[model samples]
Target: MVWEYEVRYQCLRERDKAYTNWLNRIPHKQYALAFDGGYRWGHMTTNLVECINSVLKGARNLSITALVKLHASQLASGNIQVSCFDRQNEVFKVREMPSGLEFAVDLRGLRCDCVEFQVDRIPYRHVFACCASQQLDWQVYVHDVYKMDQVRQVYRARFRSLGNPTTWPAYNGPWFVPNSYLTRVTKGRPKMTRLLNEMDTRMLRRPRHCRLCGVEGHSHNRCRQSAGANADRDAQ
Candidate 1:
């Protein structure tokens, strides 16, 4: 998809060099997915539903703590291997045992080539291995949003409840509602605002077909094989 974006960008640049030049003036990391380090989750041009769908498409249905625990367990298994580079930067190359696949880990930037570390805002197995190799603290890379202290801080605020509607201040703002007369008397559930993506498309059943003749255009009632069956039924 990033390659698709790149192809579109190149087309736009070729169509109008001036516009592309202006676009290049802005920081790529601020407006480009290719440079965002998987932080934006490709929501720049998406609607609310699309944005939420895009973000959760790759996320597991587990809680942050549960995912963290799972990753920690993988690290504790000692199946992953890490090799720190000699450069001044805190970059390490990690390889998973019995898999031979390697991932580049940048401790200084708090990111891994696998993107699990940066995207989740938590240290995954690769990050855990990198930290162990460097003797650094993996907790330092975790975002405060996933911490218990932040959750407790949210409840510290005093939210005094408004007693009842009768004692409340008189409302002066104009009220509006849908015109009931214009509403449709539909039979099924109302359609959602979301545009059906590939995932939704996969769940849909195929088009109707003629079971009697094994043809798609018409059903069994209209099929040529149905005539013989109808004649037999009439005699019966």
Candidate 2:
């Protein structure tokens, strides 16, 4: 597969100089599966990274100290919620809806028709209802990752207070230097927003052109030039 991609890339480079330059600008090792040690552990794209960035977008503007406090508070509150949920003895009933949709939950098997229990590893509305009906412990259905123990473990490490910079130990290592050639000058105000990719564009449909005649509306196999050539061969 890597060899095929390299061949196709070479063909593209031979055909288009601009495309070749654009391809060269990208790190092929990261994007190409043919490259050695390019495995991404089932993560083919940056969707996870983008999701995390979006989740922390608001926190990005906060001061480092404030952000740390916010995170600690959130973890503390989450642990409290988990503890409260664990102590709950809420009862549920399997009530039939007008729409004829009845949810059956099995706490023993940890399965629910709603599928939320399986996917989220947490008890869904139906599971809660079932647990209430059977008077079973619903907390057991919740995944361990969301338990109070796990939440506490996540925030177990305490942040140490940063002392005065003047009191810090002096570095005896080699002095650091910056390369003037690598430094970039700001021509204008930096863009704070992310640019949309081709997938995000409204104009998605591209006109197909005939590869043989270099014309629209037909492909190489159905081109007039190819038909004419076939006719000439038949005549010969």
**Which RMSD values do the candidates have, in order?**
24.4, 28.0
lDDT of 2: 0.65
Model number with the top TM-score? 1
Candidate 1 lDDT (Cα, 0 to 1): 0.77
The 0-to-1 C-alpha lDDT of every candidate, in the order given, reads: 0.77, 0.65
Q: Compared with the true structure, what per-residue lDDT tens digits does model 2 show for residues 1-236?
A: 46677788989989988887988898877667556364662354345456655556668778999888877765544221101122244322233342345444555566655677788998866766565545667788888998889999988999898799999899899998999889998876776454333323343466678988899867889898999999999999
Task: Write candidate 1's Cα lDDT for 1-236 as tens digits.
Answer: 46766888899988999888998899878877667786665345344457555434444477998767766665655688888774478888999876678989887787788888778888888888778877888888888899999999999999999899899999999999999999998976786754454335443558678987778867788788899988999999
Residue 117, candidate 2: Cα error in Å is: 1.0
- Residue 100 displacement (Å), model 2: 0.9
Model 1: colliding residue pairs: none
The Cα error of candidate 1 at residue 102, in Å, is 1.6
Superposition-based RMSD of candidate 2 using all C-alpha atoms, in angstroms: 28.0
Which 10-residue window in model 1 sums to the lowest lDDT?
194-203
TM-score of every model versus the real structure = 0.34, 0.26
